[model samples]
Target: MPGTPGKGEEMASDLSQSLPKRTFKYQSSLPPLPVPSLENSLSKYLEAVRPFASEDEFKATVQIVRKFQDGVGKVLHYKLLQRAKTKKNWLEEWWFDTAYLEVRIPSQLNVNFGGPGPYLEHCWPPAEGTCLERASLLIWHTLQYWNLLLTERLAPQKAGKTPLDMDQFRMLFCTCKVPGVMKDTIHNYFKTEREGPCPSHLAVMCHGRIFTFDALCDGEILTPPELLRQLRFVKDRCEGEPEGDGVAALTSEERTRWAKAREHLINIDPHNKTILETIQSSLFIISLDETKPYSTPENYTNMTLEALTGNPTLRWGDKSYNLLVFSDGTFGSNCDHAPYDAMVLVSMCWYVDQQLRLTDGKWKSTLMQTVIDCGNVHFVR
Candidate 1:
């Protein structure tokens, strides 16, 4: 007879067997993201520019567009067609490179998405002195959601029963934009169910200091108690120590400026590049904010603005997600728009919000927990 299973073992077995194959099951059969025809694109472009262009400017633009459409555009279209023949999703790479990497603007206001926390509605009202506890629980739920994505257990996203494209969901974790002189590139360490070994480390930011530790220990995600211990250790050290230089600010600068600064930084010290690599390779950033509560309707608006742009000191604007934990136990997120759209983060946040609601934002751990020592990452500048 088989031995009786422990609670954890039984839970794991049930989860593995009960999860439906919904998330990426239909990805292969879904149509490729479409490319607009040159004529349609040019016509739409002209229409869009009409309000901004003078009559002479409009005429000149129209002539130029027509000439290009008849000349170089045909060749470009042919090339695109030829390329599409061999590629499963011909537009995906080009869209990513052009729409995100090549844009040389400040990404904080322009490319990052920020939103208010839903916990204010239920399961943990804005309460003082609960930030750390709430953050620990949020992080635990986040890791569980990440595991769902990794294991292909999350329900497939759809549009009225039709499966929508899920390619962007891959960038939700273990992704960051690497700065370049002319264009930045995304470094995505996330893998599909078939692909193996996504990065398991989580990066935490507090008091202008950044630290990273493995979220997984002994092949299981660290319990909320363990996460709380680690988070508290970082928070306590940050409180005691003077602030770090907040080198992450460079990421908020204009792309080219940041790229140049990054180059200089790397040249100044080889370790700088390694630190950048470490951050880029981590799953996501957890920002431990020390802001006081502003939970009123009017205050919520201010809080949203602050969350969107508040402290560059502790944020890595290029990372796909930055979960902000306020001192009042409220939360918010800033997400880079390059790798994925807002909906991917929205879905993840929604999942966590629902989970928190179900459990009253409390962890159900029984282990005897002690503070785990957290180490800070130092850059020689």
Candidate 2:
């Protein structure tokens, strides 16, 4: 009966049988980009940040923050340009490239983030002349600014779009570290070489991001050396056309390497204990870029969190909860200094909580009461 079939018909049957079945649902199309309201709200938000500092201190702080933004923004902007320039006949590819540097500049600068004291954000006790406090304040301001920029990017002006989540927040956090640390370390190291920033090496680890900038500076100049700058942002080798630009498909050999690296990162560092704990139990790491082959130690934490949040199996204590919320969520607050920097973290949490409330219906007014009340006021330790 098969031999008796027509030649054209049989060929069609065989071809259809050999092809894989298409079982997945087809996605119709991507929706248009959202138009966020934050663009209009940004000015208002920043203006609100102003009254938190005195007129003189606020003006000086604004200038310093601007300079900091300009310096770091230039580096980031130029890096993007250089990357585009290197692609073979890159002009053709420019239209498709959407990379951008989002900058966050705070409206005010205050050392009393923790409570009513001379602390940078909280009650850690200010160092001599309050240099450490000021430097920490700068770092906090810059970080907050970056978050604002990111929040603006993810504004829910468009339909069917959700606000940006923790993963995007993580990307911004990592990227800002280089510039933020560099700015702080340079300002503080020269200003107070005798006391240094911290009393111990642990301080160095806590603020290690600053070291990247220090390593960039040779000695005489504040700017990074040309070689270091080139190394950090430039990519000479072509990674080749990759799939999805999200989570890269890895080979068996590569997987083994990643497994080993993960173990080392989780087991080796005492300073990273909090980060490791999050990874072992309740942190989620979603891939921001899928096409690239590179991965971060952060991914391990993300992978674990994919299953463990609010799960009964994992019993994270007060310390763990605070760490997870502080690190994972964009919301910042004042808290115990033992697990995290209560000074910076507390202020950040308070700021974020206030901001989020503003976005939600809970806060009736545009200006946060805390901003006015807590401005220059310290939290009781």
Please give the CA lDDT of all the candidate structures: 0.79, 0.25
- lDDT, candidate 2, 1-381, per-residue tens: 111212122111121233232111111232322323332334454577797988897787667656755687456556655664554333323331221111122101111012211122223222233222222232323323332322232222223543222222222222111112111100111111221221100001110010112111222111112222222221111122222211111101122343344355447765544443322222111111111111123333332332223211111111111111111211111111112233334333444334333333121223222211111111111
**Each candidate's clash count:** 2, 27
Candidate 1 residue-wise lDDT, 79-193, digit = tens: 9988888887898788888788898989877878887787877777778988898888888778777777787777777789888887788889999988888999888999855
Q: Show the lowest summed lDDT stretch of 10 residues, model 2.
A: 199-208
Q: Where does candidate 1 have its weakest 10-residue lDDT segment?
A: 1-10
Model 2 spans with C-alpha error above 4 angstroms: 1-129, 153-170, 174-262, 265-274, 277-381
TM-score of each: 0.83, 0.18
Error of 2 at 264 (Å): 3.6
Which whole-number lDDT from 0 to 100 does residue 32 have in model 1? 62
